[model samples]
Target chain A: MFASRPVVHPMEVAAAPANPAQQQQPQGVLMKDLPGMPGTPSGLALRVTQFLLAAVSLAVMSSTSDFASVTAFCYLIAAAILQCVWSLSVAIVDIYALLVKRCLRNRRLVAFFAIGDLIACGVIFSGACAAAGITVLIAQDLLMCSENHCSSFQTAVSMAFMCSFSLAPSFVLNFWSTAFAYRVVAAG
Target chain B: MFASRPVVHPMEVAAAPANPAQQQQPQGVLMKDLPGMPGTPSGLALRVTQFLLAAVSLAVMSSTSDFASVTAFCYLIAAAILQCVWSLSVAIVDIYALLVKRCLRNRRLVAFFAIGDLIACGVIFSGACAAAGITVLIAQDLLMCSENHCSSFQTAVSMAFMCSFSLAPSFVLNFWSTAFAYRVVAAG
Candidate 1:
């Protein structure tokens, strides 16, 4: 059942060589080792994606107030969806490295990192939910204004629910990552 | 002039045990001899603080639409003050240890956590500025409405700034923790 599993160290899986000398060299001559920077390519990509998402979110907020502006709303939704995808990708990669690769050899490091990942995932998830909720609330507000039959309290409740729901995903991610990290670290 | 400095390998410093048992009772002890749970004190305290802060933020958001009423708005000032205290304490205790004691003792972990701290500080600073701007905008709106000169652009700007600012601190905190945890895993 586990015939294809790789016996990789957790640290090795997480640590990508950042020093140019340690990178793939031309035609097999041993390159001199140098101090490497931290963070993997995936991590770097995620950071860039996060920054882009933040920028798009800011731009959307600045450009529109009416939720009915489909273009602006779509932009916001796109940025959020992108964030979710990035987060899930990271989570999946981490899990894969831990499981199939048996890469979680260093228990301490894994535990710490897992906790951190969980928290980040939770926050991002929550933010997404909140964004969606806000959109719905705005739509409801517009509808209420036109109809003059809806209670403000209902809108407030919806907003609260939305914000809380959005926060939940990130929190769950954080918890899961932390638990996994702890197990790895303790095992090591 | 440099009498106080002790020469030690960075790896040794980075991997130093948090528990005295790991250091002092190694011959008689197994890995489990050390406390099963690490950083329990700090972890518990942090969780409590986070809960309280979250509660305050929720209350503030629920009470008023005025940005000033948001607990996170106040936290900008609080975080600035806390940053000073934390930074000074870190310096006094050995910056490396302070940064990575509870997380893990690795250069990558320390660096990541430091970055996280910096991000959190930056978010708080920016949020405070945005909140101040919001207060000003609110005042302007009140004056304009009384004089029948209110503009939607001003409202849009205020909302944009507030939303942007609101997201920063938590976002930074999330990423910071995640990155730090990942480093811990890598280094472990």
Candidate 2:
């Protein structure tokens, strides 16, 4: 298990690569080399799913009458729109990378994806919770919603929740890839 | 910038250590070796702050009359309680590490901390948004809350937000360190 290789200087190990961000082309150094990560087929699929769910949520909320009157619903609408735009943009990137057969393993790009996904995750989660909370209050406690309005509000909230769920895996995968990239920089 | 190191075996590098979990005591490495990471003094301070803020939020929410009647407020209470318990436990661990001058740079432990912090961040954020939304509705849209209840709810939401803010740095630091650890294992 201890096959020796030619000696390399510690300073060499410490030195940064000329283009570190674009340098990782792991031949056989480790496990599958960032498999199923962002910029891959799986990532493209995730992004597409996110975009569709967010769009559906946004459409549902937009169709609801006077949804703008409730602050929570308004926030949900805004978040859904943000999610839709962000996911669609990333999906387009993923498609281009797939068409060109280029790996999206650049540390910088993955870091950007990770941070962006995190922000989206937080914002969407907050929106869904807020909308759901208000819907609950309106339907159960306040008794303020007509049957039709109440159903529309509930549908929009549920759609928002579905959007959040679809975004979760993307968030986790991006985070892991980014974390691994940072680790590679330090260890190398 | 290319320095060489003594020859080491590819197999040995690939081989897992007998106690990999306890073996990371980086010395003479770049970037100060996980400075301000979890289990350090800075980490301890973060945990303490999170605990105090969560506890205060919980206390305020508990003191409010009819808070349980609102699902959103109940969620906030639950999240705050969870935050307090989680943060306090981690703080105790941090204290032990500090007193003994032991670094908590174990990759596994740090990974655990990162995941836990992420969960707590999401939960707290959602709870804060939900509570804030309902509070706004009650006070402004519905005009159902008495002056005293409205003020108390507002205070609790603000504290919960503060708790989330304090947790953010801790989450980021732990994530970075854990990412580095994973990289080391892969790139060795």
Candidate topping lDDT: 2
Measured by TM-score, how close is model 1 to the native structure?
0.28
Best by DockQ: 2
TM-score for chain B of all predictions: 0.32, 0.81
TM-score of each: 0.28, 0.81
| Candidate 2 TM-score, C-alpha based | 0.81
In model 1, the Cα lDDT at residue B22 comes to: 50
Each candidate's root-mean-square deviation in Å? 15.5, 6.6
- lDDT by residue (A77-124, candidate 2, tens digit) is 999999998999999998998899876767677768878988887788
**Candidate 1 on B1-188: residue-level lDDT in tens?**
12232222334434554565654543211223111112233433343343344334334433444433333344444554454344344333443433565433343434454454545444433443333333333344234344322233233323323433443333344343444355345444
What is the C-alpha local distance difference test score of each model? 0.38, 0.78
> Residue A96 of candidate 1: its Cα lDDT?
60
Q: List residue ranges in candidate 1 displaced over 4 A.
A: A1-76, A87-188, B1-188
Question: lDDT, candidate 1, residue B176?
Answer: 38
How many collisions per candidate? 22, 7
